[model samples]
Target chain A: MTRRLSLFNLTSLIFGFAFLYLPILLLVVYSFNASRLVTVWGGFSTQWYGALFRNEALMEAAWVTLRIALLSATLATVLGTLAALALTRYGRFFGRTLFTGMVYAPMVMPEVITGLSLLLFFVAIGLDRGFWTIALAHTTLTMCFVTVVVQSRLMTFDRSLEEAAMDLGAPPLRTFFAVTLPLIAPSIVAGFLLAFTLSLDDLVIASFNTGPGATTLPIKIYSQVRLGLSPEVNAASAILIGIVTLGVVVATLLTKRSAARARRDGH
Target chain B: MAERSLTRKLTASLVPALPYLWLGVFFLVPFLIVLKISLSDPAVAQPPYKPVFDWSDIAGFFSQLDLDNFETLVGDDLYLSATLSSIRIATISTILLLLVGFPVAYAMARAPERHRPLLVALVILPFWTSFLIRIYAWIAILKPEGLLNQGLMALGAISEPLTILNTEWAVYIGIVYAYLPFMVLPLYAALEKMDDTLLEAALDLGSPPWRSFWTITVPLAMPGIIAGSLLCFIPAVGEFVIPDLLGGSETLMIGRQLWSEFFSNRDWPLASAVAILLLIILVVPIVIYRDVEARRLETES
Candidate 1:
């Protein structure tokens, strides 16, 4: 029975990973195709990569997307960390339920609703729907994800170390910065990365909030895709996949090293 | 001493106050604006909708607010059918995600302890990739002259290419592909945390393996099942990119309807009403998720 079950489990993993990965691998492979016809492979070539670089619009959009992601992610991490701190530490504040609702609602709210509503709100307030508007919208949308990530880490945190600091005459604020912050830094970093990726990945919300000058990479890719498939677009997609993979890998390695160092310090 | 302490107190209060104010303005206010826009009449003017409220006459503003857009939603079959189809697609896709996601999550949970983290990371890697890129990858595979057809033809499985692209079937594949991670992650969390000894003990007793799994594993994984379902179902219902990129013109999901109404038709009021109704359908699930999260957090803390 155990043998059969192991076989069953292995089969499930094989099929699932294939389904998950094969499409993406195919996309990356097609990016290297030399033919103008995207479905046909003439030979392996770097022409699309060169074409992608010369596509001024795509490059500009990528720059704008990176800026927006960076700004919004920083803003979200700060606010979300505060919110997480409030949820975990500030027991029974006024309007806690409403605050919690505000935090949680955005995570599951349909992007269209969020997008439309944010657009309406901006118009009503007479805010110009430009780069700043996209940044603010992304910050609001992504903060909840950060809060969830950081809050989980905050829950698992050892409070005795914090208590020990306070017992040794450290002020509450000082102790938090000196002890709590360092311990939870890994989660905050994780939250920031998640928020950054979400900002970069957004289309619908950015679509609604965007104006003439604020075209994001996702918005750009989407319009090109609607026109039809191309190797250049495939190359662009492959590059994005590469960047995200590299970022996640680097982050994992950094976190692992820090954790090991902390473990050694404890011993 | 008093002045110093007062300054410290104010600084202490700043932590929660800042986030609270940010969410109130950017999150809560936008939703209120959506509600207001949903009630107003459509217009050809700038900002698209006439102001229903006048600062001078608040009571008159209340009277001016009418259900014209909502009435149009009820009167027009387009809005009704779009909403129904959206729900239908979301419901079906959610079930498909569960079917595909559960076995994979179970396998990951039952894997060797050292390999579990790597498995979870593998599942999440694709999620980090651009959502547009993932959907675009399928267009290459599903188009009439796409790879799927070529492969099938080469194998002599069919003489002609299957017309899968720009159809509801393509939309299903896109949705199931895009949201698979959302379904699997929570289920993995639940299943991994489960006590395997219980299953072992059940098998050691009179119960068979399958029966023990049905009784012990399935019941314990119920919470994850609900979480994964809500996570996938809610967003899948309002999915715009998948349906637009993959589905035929006849797809008629509410997200696309909302997009067209707002963008193509420039009927902001009607679009707002569509958004409002979508919110209503989603509210129950959103609240349930919040409840689950709150309980989970409470127990953890």
Candidate 2:
């Protein structure tokens, strides 16, 4: 019986890993293929990568995407951290449940609904639908993620450190910056990266909010795929995969190192 | 001490009040706009920007809310079938993910502690890639002269290439492929925390292996299963990219329907109505989850 269970587990492990990795592996391989047809395995060439660089519109979209991601991620992290701190530090108050629910609603709400509502809201407010609108929508969604990550970290935090700083006559703001912020720094960093990745990968919200001139990379990729994909897209996708994988690894390592340092500090 | 007390009072009063104001302005305001628009009449070329509070407009609004949009939805057999098809596709995909994810999660849970991180990384690596690109790659695999068919033909399994692309099967494959990790991670978290001794105890009580698994393991993992199912099902219902990219022209889902209603028909009222219905469907599960979580917290406390 144990042997059968082990065999079942082994099969699932192998199939599951292969299922996840194979398509990505194929995509990476085909990015270097000289042939335009994705199935044909021609000799390796970096020509598509060069083509991707020379595509001016794609470059512009990529730049806009990066700008939006960075700005929105920073804003979302700040607001989310404040929200999380407020929720965790204070006991229940009037409208606390409603506020918590509102904060989380965007996280699980269908992106289509969120995008449509925000689009309508922009139209109603007489705001031109453009990059700033897209950033606002992204921040709304990304802040929820940041709140979740930061809130989890806050839950594990010991409260005495803040009290000690106050007992030593440090101001509340100074105590926050010096003691509390340093303790939750890893979570803050994690939340920022998560927000950045989410903003970068967003297509639905950006699609609804964007004007003609404010195309994001995911929107560009979506339109390109719809118009029938080219190998240049494969090359572009390969670059994105590499950049994100590297970012995740580096962030993970940084957080681990910071956690180790925090343990050593014994505070 | 006086200054400290003053500071604490100030912080207590000011800090918690701020987030509520922020959420009210941004989050709740937009949602309220959606609800207002959903109730507004379509005859008005552009509905009023601010919600109309006049008693006559309010009465007319409620009176005109005669399910015109919903009647249009139900009158069309296509939309009805599409919703059902979407639910079926989502359910199947979720089940497949569970079947495939369970073993991998179990292996990870049972693996040497040192190797656990590596396994978890493998599970998450695909998630970091572009979702569109991942779905697009399936086209290469499922196309008529594609890799899968070609490989199968070469192996003498069949003479004719199978028609796999642009079908319900393709949609299922795409969804399961995309969401399998979501299922695995939560299940792994649950399984890893499980006490193996419970299983051993069941075995020592003369229970068979399957019996022990059903009695001990499955119940212990119910939270993970419920969470994973909700994660997979909700997105699958609203999924636009997968069905669009993989299922092609034949796949009629609510998401694609909503897109067409907005972009093609330009019927904002109908689109808003559809969005409201979708939101209604989602709210039930979300409320249930919150209730369950709150109950669990209360019990734990």
Candidate 3:
């Protein structure tokens, strides 16, 4: 099985990557197409890119989406890191089962259910559905994802560094900030990036919890898409894909560098 | 020293408490509210549901709540059919994902160690992209004048464009496309960890490759298979965006129905009932996932 690629293996890899990649590649290529028709190519042009910038409402939604992503990702990172610490560090506590369930449930729960339930909760509590509500919803949903990422890092985390720092008389908080945080910082950043992209990508939760004046980029693009295919949406999606790709690349490089550093230092 | 110990204890307990409180309020409490709303009657007022749970008149609030929404769900065949259809669609899509995902995962697992990471990253890169955009990409490809049809036509494979968009076939393709990563990642993780010697041992005993693969590789990969299938199947059951965007208006998935119930029809109580039922249906699989995760963590730790 580990030998040279058989026909089955070669075909699978070729078709798999093509299937995974071709659609998005086509979408990106079509963004620069001169034709208004989404699929057909008259020639290469960046008209849609120009139109994307000129579209005021879409721009506003994009701005809103970015701010929400930033705020919620930062918040989710902190909370999720704490939750990871709780799960990994704390041995056993009251309601541990329930705590674990709550953290994991949101990760796999249906968006519609999560969205609908949150909207209901907001209504029941008399909280207005708007920017803050959407942020809260995104935080709740994305924090679990953050927890999963950070928890994996924490599980494999070396404890001797913190212990050595403690043995040298550093306080717990100081040790965490000075030692543990630096070592796990890469994962924290990774978790933040994950949360950020997820928040940016979410449409369902935002849709349910949204109110007047809180349209996100996905919502804007969705409304336009429903009307018909347009090069404008292709341009917008291309830009979004570009941002996420850049973030992922940066995070991957950071993690790789840190891993290499750890290997060097370990020996 | 005593004061320091007290502060340390306070923070020690406090760390777990913060996230506990956050999830308890936002995650657990909201679910309770959904359950309560589902049992209540729908109204035309603000919030669109009745029996708002007046704390002072708790008795009255409890009395007002009934199984009306659940009754509605039972009496009407739409909800039942939608739920059944969603299950059917999710089941088939999970199988298709396995069919498409297994070979790629196996190939990736068998790839050179240095190249495996890059392959994994490529698989995950698209997953990190927007779900809506991915489905939107399919809309362009599957449409009559879209890429697939045009490519086929140009190749002289067909004289006329095939209509695949806005059909169940499109939904299947979209699910397989989107969830391939979910399926592959876990399977790769399992398969990659497998010991090569066991398969070799089987073959050394004169068993054929296919026989050894079925008996050795498949059983060893059971955990991954289960994990991957549950990962894809559970969420696929309650999927909203894929069905709404890719499937036609006639698509009867519960997620789409719930969206319409809550958004277009404004039947908040009924939507709550739908959500409750969906949660109930998925409870078994979710619990299984949690059990598997707990065991995995236990073993890892």
DockQ of each candidate, alpha-carbon based: 0.67, 0.53, 0.74
Q: Which stretches in model 3 have alpha-carbon errors above 4 Å?
A: A1-3
Predicted structure 3, TM vs. truth: 0.98
lDDT for model 1: 0.92
Could you list the CA RMSD of all candidates, in the order they appear? 1.6, 3.0, 1.3
Q: Per-prediction interface RMSD?
A: 2.3, 3.3, 1.6
**Could you tell which candidate, 1 or 2, scores higher by TM-score?**
1
Model 3, span B1-301: residue lDDT tens: 9998999989878878888899999999999999898988888898787856777998888888899889999999999999999999999999999999999999888887878899999999998999999999999999999999999999999999999988999999999999999999989989999998998888889999999989989998888899899999999999988888889887889999999998899999999999999999999999998888777777776
Between candidates 2 and 3, which one is better according to lDDT? Answer: 3
Model 2: per-residue Cα lDDT over B34-131, one tens digit each: 77766655653554332434576766656655456777777989778878877778788889888888888888887777778889988987887777
- For model 2, the superposed segments whose C-alpha errors exceed 4 Å read A1-7, B1-14, B43-66, B293-301
lDDT tens string, model 1, A88-165? 888898999898889899989999999999899999889899899999999999999999999999898788999999
User: Which docking class does model 1 fall in?
Assistant: medium
Ranking by TM-score: 3, 1, 2
Q: Find the candidate with the highest lDDT and give its number.
A: 1
Residue B266 CA displacement from its true place in model 3, Å: 0.6
lDDT of 1 by residue, B74-114 (tens): 99998889889999999999999999999999999988887
